[model samples]
Target: MISILFAVLTALSNGTASVLQRRAAADAPEEDALRLSLLRDLLRKGIWIGGIAMSAVAAVCQAVALATGPIAIVQPIFVIELPFTLLLGGLLFHGSFPRSVWLAVAAVAGGLSLFLLAAAPSGGDASVTTGFWPEALLVTGLFLAALLAVGLRVRGNARAATLGLAAACGYALTAATMKDAMARLDHGVGAFFTGWQLYATAAIGAGSLFVLQNALQAGSLAASQPMLSIGDALISTCYGVTLFSESLRTGWWLVPQLAALALVLAGCIGLSRSPLADGLAPRPDDRPRTDVPAAV
Candidate 1:
């Protein structure tokens, strides 16, 4: 119960921070991008840096949650964050969500819960060996390469989704590293290159977030967010299982996971179909334009 509550609070904080950061990014003048102001550019400093600081706090809380809770329990409850994210955009940013989006969110929530229920218990003890480094790094490299290539080839919302997927890969690999870090906390691996995994995790986690916000800032949140949620959950879950030794009880567990994946796909599709979107149109705006004759 405590762990779950902590996860909820963390997710809420995370969502709020994400929305604020996105808004700030959306409104920022490109000329002043992260520049140190001549005088006291308190607004710039606060909007950019402060939002990031709050996100850092949320990240720490999330890391703690992952360190303590079962992946199944933690990941599903974290999915509530997707709804909360859209809710934040609606309330604070004046963004409106369509009915189908709500339905998809509801479907995703239900499916994710069922997925968790069908999974094995995982909150006991986690220990990972340094021997797995080769396998972990190889898989991480593969995900990185695939996502990067996909991100480059795509445009607009699809590009954003690919970038988010890349970020997820980084984050999940970092989670695996964190597990290794936790294992080496008391060891003398600190003075030299003994705890590469720990620092690698921190670097990956932090870097991925930076990339995530940049990707979000490049396009519509509705278009980008579903991918973020689904990708993050999948990456984190796989990290738990593959690198951190988390597991499922039975083969039947795959069924719920696939069902949840379908729900996630539906949610993404619903978000894409929103009236707020420009549809398959190239431009970001949905306003009807007067058809002007081409120059002779």
Candidate 2:
């Protein structure tokens, strides 16, 4: 239960960060995408910095959640971030959502709840076996590379979706490594520091952030958020099962899980089609008054 609570916090923090970062990324020059210059430009924006701060908070919460519970349980909770992002975007941008958006949000929530209830993921080892690392890393690396190649070749929504999925994979790998590193803490401080997984987590997380920025820059949140949220959840579930040996309800339970996934997919499609997903406009009163004199 504590893990679930922390996972929710992680989702909240991540949702807020996504909105802020999306705002900043939308204004960035297209030429800067997938380049270091993108981050350099973002660093100059107060909003982007704020987003990074929130991401740091999310990382802390996620670490605690992963350390305490099965990654399958902790990671899937992040699917709520999609709805949270939409809701937060409305509030921050002074926009209102319609009834359809509300219904879609409900569907996403309900589906996630159903899936978790049906799957009942549990009983994972704290640390992954050493032998699994090389194969996992190699496969993950190739998958990311292929995605990045496709992302670079595409434009608009396609580019955004491709890059978003790539980023999701990177994030899943980061979580897996982070969990492995955290397990080292049980041994000693020296073990935690010496563990290669700690370094791997840091490297992978930073790369994921870079890819996410590119995704935001390529198109509207409507095009990318679903891929990011859903891909991460599914990929992390695989990592939990294969690497950590987590258990889930099987046999007839798969029926409910598939149905729940369809519900979530439908909700995602609905939310993506809503006007709010394209970026909400500020209320008339919230707009800057150009008629006002400068303070200087």
- lDDT by residue (1-296, candidate 2, tens digit) is 99999999999999999999998788778999899999999998888999999999999999999999999999999999998898889777755689999999999999999999999998989999999989999999999999999999999999999999999999999999999999999999999999999999999999999999999999888888999999999999999999999999999999999999999999999988886785443335653467998555
lDDT of 1 by residue, 115-218 (tens): 67677547444556657778878878987888777766666677667776777677666656665566565565573246676678778876777667655655
C-alpha lDDT of residue 226 in model 2? 94
Residue pairs of candidate 1 with colliding backbone atoms:
none
Count of steric clashes across candidates, in order: 0, 0
Lowest-lDDT window of 10 residues in candidate 2? 279-288
